[model samples]
Target chain A: MIEVKNLIKEFEGRVVLDDISANFQKGAVNMIIGKSGSGKSVFLKCLVGLIRPTSGEIRYGGRNFLAMKNREMKRLRRDMGMLFQGSALFDSKTVLENVMFPLDVFSRKNQRERRKRAEFCLERVNLLDAADLFPSEISGGMMKRVAIARAIALNPKYLFCDEPNSGLDPKTSQMIDELIQDITRDFNMTSLVVSHDMNSVMNIGDYILFLNEGIKEWEGSKEHIMDSDNDKLNDFVFASDLFKKIKEADAIITGNEANEENRKKLIQRMEEEAKDL
Target chain B: MTITGSLENIGEYALLMKRVLTPPDRMREFFREFFKEMYKLGVNSIWIVVIISFFIGAVIVMQIALNVASPLLPRFTVGAVSREIILLEFSSTIMCLILSGKVGSNVATEIGTMRITEQVDALEIMGINSANYLILPKITAFVAFMPVLVIFSMFLGLYGGYVICYLTGTPPVSTYVYGIQAFFRESFVWYSIIKSMIFGFIIASVAAYYGYSVRGGALDVGRASTDSVVINSILILMTDLVFTQLAMG
Candidate 1:
């Protein structure tokens, strides 16, 4: 589990992340969702130590992550895996070599053992045939899979993905989302994903933290997201026509009559739930 | 760039060098990358170095012979002038200037692209020292192979001069050979070698500093590559002047 307390990040006097606090549960797919420049990326970078927080405390599995020394941080980082939006595979290396790189750096295994482990990782990602191929030759979805394989190559205890499905088509995005969910559960690792894709949010966000203009606008599970009343979050989550219709249908099913007074009351109840949750 | 910006860049470059010189996390992998870089930086550069050095030698011989039209001057002076110029300056300094364009831009572009693509961040996430992993091998390769290239350049340069002298028959083969062998101080060779090694280090490290610190996207990578080549050339020339002053003052 990762716990963030009063996390604030500023850039040259401009606040990118306001005082926000949240917990990412272990063995679950936790998501940070926001619009462009809403501080989701900033929050993710801070969590991963890519960017230092202006002020905050980050505890990883009960240890003070922010106060750890460089060597201690590096030791912790070995158990952490990150997948970038672009997949971030070494273009010069083959898929097999990419997966085996972490092992080469950290593992005491011999050449044959490393090869076997790499092959196993590729097989796990259903990329066994692409083991010899370079990243440039693969499709975007395949590249994500290769990135996933490489991330799990060391059997990391934490997985962080930044916009895992950015350029992918809907079907591929859904597939990638499910893959992340499945891996999180199977490996029992804390998986934190930064994404704006509503499809991913609704599908795989076991826990979601929504930010708007650098502030925590809402926080809840996917099941409760639809019921959220925060106007900022509602504007974002129900911005689509399909979701707006769903909200109308849900209002009717819940026997609220879709009246102004009752609708306002429902939103009020949701706001309360947002605070309590 | 402003004075403050230049100073910041220098400070950052120094910090990057400090990180790069640290002991690598995995020696086996480091050596593997070192060997690969050796092939890329050294073996792949031989033909271009040879071709350029040969032409430079031939040109120096032809130009020197043209200028000394008076019969009062000995023809062997052409051989001596060409030999001194090629050994002391052309093979080390000029060859490095050429490589600053060739190898420096390549190193910068490669690392810059990786930076933009987030491959460097991925390495860091894996608990690897990205600077050491990405740069130390190239530095090692440059330091190891550049001297060999300079030596080869000197040999080919002398051969080119000999060919031109033989073809012109003005200095004659025996007189040119005698001139080349005359007053040959071993210290000049040492100076040339030291200069080449320093040039190689400057090219690799300066290019890498620009490349690894690049931000933004593909355009930034291109800009970094250009910056790397320009900066490397300026630094190499400056270092050449300083080394010459210090070594042969």
Candidate 2:
């Protein structure tokens, strides 16, 4: 589990992450969700040590990440894996080499062992045929898969993904989301994902932390998100007409009884909204 | 920027150098990377250096022969002048200027693209010191290979002079050879080699500094590459002056 206490990050006197505190449980897809410029990325960066928090304590498995010495921090980082927004694959390296990179640096395994492990990782991602292909030769979704394969090569205990669904089509995005969720469960790792995609929020957000203007707006599971009465959360989540229609449909199905004629009218309105969308 | 900003950048550059100088976590990987860099920065650069030095040497000899219309001067003066210019300035300083465009911009563009694309961050996240992994091999490769290139430049430059002189028949081949052999101070060879090595360090490190510090997007990467070339050229020339003063004075 990861615990953050009074995390604050400032840039040029502008507050990006304000005194926010939250707990992310282990073996779950813990998501940080918010609109653009809402400090979701900043908060994630702080958690992963990409950006230093102005003042806070970040405890990873009960050890203070901020107070660790450089050597100690590096040792801890060995068990951490991150998938970047752009996939961040080494352009010059083939897929097999990319996945084997961490092992090459940190593993005591022999060359054949490293190659076997990398091949196993590629197979796990269903990318064994693409082992010899360079990153530029692959599609965006494939690149994300390759990145995931590389991230898990070291069998990290903590997995962080920054906007993993960005720039992907909806279907591919769903696949990536499922892959991340499955990996989290299978590896039993503490996974933190930063995203603004509501599909991801609804699909894989086992636990979600909502931020708005650098402050925590709400925190709960996807099951409880719709029941959240917070206006800001509602505005952000229901900004799309399709979700609004879904909310209305849910109300029609579960709320107090209505006449058939009124229910038909409401259903017709929702169908129109869905058509417009 | 302000004076304070400039100082801050210098401090940051120094810190990066310190980090790059740290020992690698894996010697096997370090050697593998080092040899790869040597092939890229050194072996790949030989053809260009050879071609440029030959032409520059030919041009220097031609210009010297054309200007020396005095019958009172010996024909060997042309060879001496060509040898001196090639050894003292052209091979070391001018070749470095050329390489500042080739290798320096390349280093900047490659690293800047990696920076913008977050590959460097990926390395850092993997618990590898990005500076040591990326820049150290480059520095070692350039420093080791540059002196060899300068020596090659010196030899080809003299050969170029010989080819021009032999073809022109104004300064006879023997006279040209005599001039090369005349007043051959061993110190000049050392000076040129030292200068080229220093130039190698400047080109690699300055370009790396700009590349590693890049922020923003593709436009910022282009700007960093251009800035790296400009800054490397200026520093190379400035360092040449200091070295010349210290060695020649």
Candidate 3:
């Protein structure tokens, strides 16, 4: 688990991440959701030491991350893996080489073992056939999968993904979300993802932290997100017609208007509507 | 740019070098990258250097023979002049100016794209020093390999003059060969090589600094590439002047 206390980040004179505190539990997909310019990315960067926080306590497995020396921080970073929004695969490297990069630098394994490990990772991502291809030769969805494979090659304890489905199609986004969720569960890794994808939020977000203009406006699980009473959260979440209709159906079912059969029918209808959209 | 801003840039560049010149995280990976850089930046550039040196060498010989044709000056003066110019300036300083535009821009654009695309950030997150991993090999390979390029430029340049004089036969091939051998200071060859080594560092490192400093998008990367070439050209010229004054004073 990771604990953040009063995390604040300032750029020049402006505060980008206000005093915010949250807990990210292990073995779960923790999502940070916010509008554009709402500090979601900033918060994630601060958590990973990409951006320095003005004041904060970031405790990763009970150790103070901010106070560690350079060597100690580098050692700790070995347990962390990050997926950038653009995938961040080395442009010159093949897909297998990309997967094997972190291992090549840090692994104690021999060359054959490293190759086998990379092949295994590519196979896990169902990308073994494309292992010899370069990143430019792959599709966007395939690139994201390759990035995910590279991220997990080290068997990292923490996985941080930033806008993993930003440019992917809906079907591919769902697949990517499921892949992240499955990896988190299989490895019991602490997964922190910064995303505004509502489908991903509802489908795979085990816990959610919502930010508004650099402040923590709301925080909860998907079960409570649609029913949230916070006006700003509701305005953001129910902005789309599909989500609004789903919320209406939810309210209708929860209210004194229907029996179990009708509620089940309404949920089935909602799922059908979601698929059609 | 303001004085403070210029100073800040210099300060940032100095700090970045401190980071870039450190020991590599893995020697095996470092050597692998080192050879790759040598092939990319050094070996790949040889053909262009040869072509340019040959043409420029021929031109220098023809121009010197035409303009300085006189009864007082020796007939071999054209060959000697061509040799001095190629050895002291063209092969070393001017050639680097051309490379600063080509190789310098290439490094800047490549690394700038990497920076904007977050590849460098990815390296940093993995506990690797991104500056060292990306820039050190380019700098080391270019520096180590520049002397070879300069040596080639020297030979091809003299050979071009040899070929041109034989074809034209104005001063006759014998006099031109004798002129090349006359007052030929081996020190000048070493000076050119050493000066080129310094320029090689300037080219690779300054371009990398610009590329790594890029922050915005593709346009910013282009601007950084242009900035690197311009800055590299200026610095190479200035360093050439300084080195020549110190060596020949």
Q: What is the interface RMSD of each candidate, in Å?
A: 0.6, 0.6, 0.5
lDDT of each: 0.91, 0.92, 0.94
TM-score of chain A of 3: 0.92
State which candidate has the highest TM-score: 2
lDDT tens per residue, model 3, A38-147: 99999999988999999989999999999999999999898999999999999999999999999999999999999999999899889999999999999999999999
**Model 2, span A1-277: residue lDDT tens:** 9999999999999999889999999999999989999998889888878889999899999999999999999999999999999999999899999999999999999999999999998898899999999999999999999999999999999999999999999999999999999999999999999998999989999999999999999999999998788999999999987787687777777765643554677779768989999
Worst 10 residues of 3 chain A by lDDT: A253-262
Cα lDDT tens digits, model 3, B102-211, are: 89999999999999999999999999999999999999999999999999999999899889999999679999999988999999999999999999999999999999
DockQ of candidate 3 against the true complex: 0.87
Candidate structures ordered by DockQ, highest first: 3, 2, 1
lDDT string for model 1 (A9-97, tens) is: 99999999999999999999999999999999889889989899999999998988899999999999999999899999999899999
Candidate 3 ranges beyond 4 A from true positions: A257-277
Instruction: List model 1 lDDT by residue over B154-216, tens digit each.
Output: 989988888988898867888888888888888888889989999999999999999999999
What's the lDDT for residue B49 in model 2?
Answer: 95
Model 3 residue A154 lDDT? 93
What iRMS does model 2 reach? 0.6
